[model samples]
Target: MASAPQTQSLPLFYKELIPLSRQDHAKYKMRPPETAPFLANVHAVPVTVEEFPMVQRRMPIVFSVGDDAVPLALMGLNEGVNLFVDDEGKLTDNTVYLPAYIRRYPFLLARLQPESEELSLCFDPSVDWIGEFDDGEALFTDGEPSEFTKQIMQFNEQFEQAGQRTAQFVKDLREMDLLMDGEVSIQPEGAPQPFIYRGFQMINEDKLREMRGDQLRKIVQNGMLPLIYAHLMSLSLMRDLFGEQMRSGKMPQPDAGV
Candidate 1:
């Protein structure tokens, strides 16, 4: 039995979100992302368990603090700044891997009703690239999802499933008491003070190392060890991200107390 509808905060870059209904959105169309960088201000994005390996190589992966504790790929060290994005919103380094979370933007699977387990395909209507257009891909045909819409829905569904797996991964970390407070500090060559970052959680190496051999084996067998290592290794990039911020001068100084 489904619960009542729940309201979730919109993800980054989403201004206004509404369910994609055949009736309301039948005339709408979607086109490939335009030149304007929709992610320019987005410094971090959600990451799935499957994305840890690829994302770890390109971005600093960390966990959000508190009960919901989702993994995030940090693109910049501070808020309102994304080191990878240029003034035009295009990625500065095309070769770098983009997290699936960003790639799935503008479309998402959401539970419209709290009691209902069924998810609805939803979109950020404010995304300029998607709207009423005759030349672009239609969202619906004959009041049914068009092929393009179907593809988008499929991707959204996959993202949602990945999100579930990611949630479980976080839960496992919590259950194992493996998560601990994380702090990172970085200073550029000419900077007077190091940028200190906090308010995030990360895997505790000490706890992990102290785990019994059998427990460690279980995690290794489940393929979680590599993911943990990836996250720990990715923390080294905090300095690199700080360097980008210095070079671009896009963000203000890091919070003194953070």
Candidate 2:
């Protein structure tokens, strides 16, 4: 769901990335987009371990499939559907917690040179938020980044750090052999067969219970146990998401096979 910028492929939601600099963009201003059309069809998004509790309350937390598994918040049970947002990508309910990955859109810290250890603040040039607009927050003030720019930079930095911790959390789960291929089946009334959803990873609750006491204590001491439980707890919300899709008439036909 989240990808790093590379020479061959740009990260999700970014069409083109350029390092933000005063020299080239002294007059650029940032205005919040009234709608996020990019998110209209995105069903899932990468999320950090730090957001487990809050995310669990609103959506199912599942791991992306494959060797390099990362946590994802399921905005919808199926592809091309988002239960929480309208077609214009505006939140249907304002109280839902928006993931940091969504909120940090159009801006991220990336390495300007692949060989360099330092990262620079970069933004997607295609987004309407940043441009030479007259009615928005100035990106630069007197040849320096303005307070708003500084705050955005800081937020991206913190997101990067959270991403690092999330990576480690996933690594630890793999090391402990705790993740398993996940699936969920739901049968609506009058349906002849249940709808099945797969292609994700989830905590192996049985194996988690079978772990040695010392290992369990270690996870508890390291503050990972709660996060793991939070993920497990969130799985129950999958049905709620399915219901939301049904209510919105976004659910696939019974024979469509999700």
Candidate 3:
């Protein structure tokens, strides 16, 4: 039998993205998608990045109509739960995709507030995840440049933590063997699988390809609320599959994450 798959080494050289928020975040309470309970599958590693305290509080943002403090939260579509929300809000159902490049760059991102009383969330093909905004219905829509949107859309601060935190993320993977594609093959059922082989965390390219479906389902089931990287992917896939789902029917409102 082939040896266990080799784990993909964590890309540790790319952690300086904390300061990239070029936009100020203190100003707005990011809202949930106009509608929600979207699909998603996300995992949270519990390590603290003191330099960037926000890392530990990672969650998808949620917003609702007729409220004042849109919330920021953490949610996995598969879990059917939003880790955090300022208050009650609606979420959209959609799926998304991400570049493998996300592992290198912290999945920094934002879910912009919606415009009108629209019951949908729109997506942009650009790198950042942007929501609909129209002052005709709410505030911050001059078809002009402004900082509010950035507060709702920007990269996250996932890796800025205690030195050992990132090290631990690396160490966890190292302890297990990863299945690299082309290096291994899946054995037929009923065939006795090798021991010391099953336990290794599998990450083979073939396996990665197979897992594509699950990953996509994750995005759809949790599209309403997405993890940093997952949200990034949503905008892309959402565009491809449903652009109408991406836009707001009308512009509208809120704030709250406490």
Best prediction by TM-score: 2
How does candidate 3 score on lDDT?
Answer: 0.26
- Compared with the true structure, what per-residue lDDT tens digits does model 2 show for residues 129-205? 78999889998999999999999999999999999999999999999999999988889998789888888999999
lDDT digits (tens) for residues 1-258 of candidate 3: 212112233222222222222132222123333432122222111222231223222332221112121111223211222222212423332222221222222223322222323111112212222223322122133433245443323223233333345344233323332222111122323536511111112123333335456554653474311232332332232112112212322111111111
| Candidate 1 TM-score versus the reference | 0.91
lDDT of each: 0.81, 0.88, 0.26
Which candidate's lDDT is highest? 2
- Cα lDDT tens digits for candidate 1, 30-84: 8887654788877788899899889988788999989889998998877778778
Candidate 2 global TM-score = 0.95
After superposition, candidate 1 runs with Cα above 4 Å error = 1-8, 190-192, 251-258
lDDT of candidate 2 vs native? 0.88
TM-score of each: 0.91, 0.95, 0.22
